[model samples]
Target: MRLALAQLSIESAAVDDNVERAVSAIETAAEEGADCVALPEIFNVGYFAFESYERAAEPLGGETHRRIREAAIEHDVSVLAGTIVEDLAASADAGEAVPAESGLANTAVLFDADGKRRLVYRKHHLFGYDSAEAELLVPGDQLPTADLGGHTVGVTTCYDLRFPELYRRLVDDGATMVLVPSAWPYPRVEHWKLLPRARAVEDLLYVGAVNGSATFEDASLVGRSTVYDPWGTPLASSDDDATVVYADCDPDRVDEVREEFPALRDRR
Candidate 1:
């Protein structure tokens, strides 16, 4: 499978413009023969735009998702719609299960080439250090996985990478590839790069770490969107720029790595 990571140029509170960029990236990735394209976290409202969260929050089937679903069908390529600020009450009103009936959540959705909603993963770990995420959003309660392009795919958000147990759970759930939609900031570029590489090495699966590119009032994103193979090799990566990183991944590679290493089989 060919994977594309859309390291978008995010602007704070610029919903329409950001969404437009995401759709364009999807089209470009499809044209380049990418089977799946993943966007960065909060690509619409920007992760550091805390004040705009309430105004930008929408239901599961909101306009952003509608546009993404349409794009997935038009391009005939699967898409990970990155993370968005979700209104839990509105989602419940729309008959979608949410972690809470009230308040907002940092959520990510996945769509197949046929425009089907395959997975919805709210961020399980909300950042609390010098941020408002923990106080503003509800943490996800479930880990969901779906099959896409001959790979069992899983979804996680930025801070979730710090927790290796989460990726282990996905591995137990039969996931071969995990897409992480992140809005990681500057000053911690080493952590941003190291965590995903470690996750891929330990889990024996493909790890696609997608990050945004923009500077906000308080912080700036460290782009470097990358795809790490099961053997912890960087297949493709980028600097802090607005671009799409592409890599070809084989689902069979995961099995081969695991069988040759036999590390997972010896887990206690």
Candidate 2:
């Protein structure tokens, strides 16, 4: 399948503009023959927009998700709607299973080409270092994977990349590819690049690290969105530009890499 990592320019608290940009990216990816397109973290609301988290929070099937779902159906491509600030109470009222009854959560949803809600992954790790993310949003608890376009896909967010054990769990659950929607910033460019590459190497799966491109009041995003193969080889990458990084990935590559290396079999 062809995967496109959308490196979007996220404006702080600019929900409408950002969502519009995301939709445009999806359309462009479909035009480029991408089977699936993944956006960066909090594409609607900038990740550094802490004060606007509450105001921008929406339910699972809120306007932002509805728009993304519709785009997927219209474009005939699957979409990973990056991450959004979710209103847990509203989601619960809408009959969606939420991690909490109230408060907010950083959530990512996957929509199939037919506009089916394939997977919902809330961020398991909430970043608190020099940010109000931990204080403002609730962390996700479930680690789920879904099958899409002949690949077993897993979802993770920015901070979740630091946790290798989580990736191992997904591998155990039969994941062949993992999409990491991130809003990584400057000064930590090495960390952002290294972690996802390491995850792909360790799990022997496709790792698509999607990041945003924008400068906020407190931080500036490092837009090195990349797609790594099972061999830790970068298939496609961008350099801090708002563009779509595309890579053709085959699920069988994961098995082939594992069989050739025979490293995962040695795991204790």
Candidate 3:
């Protein structure tokens, strides 16, 4: 299937503008004959918009998700509406104090071709160094996967790239491909490039990293969205610009690589 990685610039706390940009990208991707498109992490409310979290956060079926669904239907293609800041106020359990304003969550939602909600994956590993994500957000419990056009796809967010165990579990659960939506900043471009390829090689699956092109504080995003095949070869990549990277991935290649190499068979 042909996948489009939408690497657009995000304005911190500019919800309407970001959503409009994402919708436009979806239309463009569809016109290019893409079967599915994935956006960058926290595309709505920029990743470092901590103070705006409470104001910008939305519920699962709120406006943000509704806009994404409408875009999917209009474009007639599946969409991985990248991570959003979730408001868990109403769902808070007893004695939880409602988290004062509501805790944030790096949540990714998937919509099928017919605009049905296919899956939702919250970010498992929250980044804390130089960011307030660890203090402001709640970690996800479920490792969600979905079937997208004959491909068993797994979903993960930016910071989760460093954790190989999570990808291993997804591979064990029959995921042939993984989609990572990221808002990775500058100065750590090496980590952003290497980690996803490493995961793809180690897991023997296709890996797609969709990143944003935005500046936060003094940090600018490294908009090198990339796709890696099972052999750890880059099939498609983008430079530091607002563009869509496309790749044609075959699920059978995963089986072929694993069968020929038998690396996974020797796992302890």
Span of ten consecutive residues with least summed lDDT in model 2 = 256-265
Compose the digit string of candidate 2's lDDT tens values, residues 1-268.
Answer: 9999999989999999999999999999999999999999999999998899999899999999999999999999999999999999999998999888999999999999999999999998999999899898888899989998778999999999999999999999999999999999999999988999999999999999999999999899999999999999999999998999999999888888889998878998
lDDT ranking, best first: 1, 2, 3
| Cα lDDT, model 2, residue 134 | 89
| Every candidate's lDDT | 0.96, 0.95, 0.89
Give, for candidate 3, the lowest lDDT window spanning 10 residues.
91-100
Candidate 3 off by > 4 Å: 91-102
Stretches > 4 Å off in candidate 2: none
What are the per-residue Cα lDDT tens digits for candidate 1 across 141-224? 999999999999999999999999999999999999999999999899999999999999999999999999999999999999
Show the colliding residue pairs in model 1.
none
Q: List the residue pairs that clash in candidate 2.
A: none
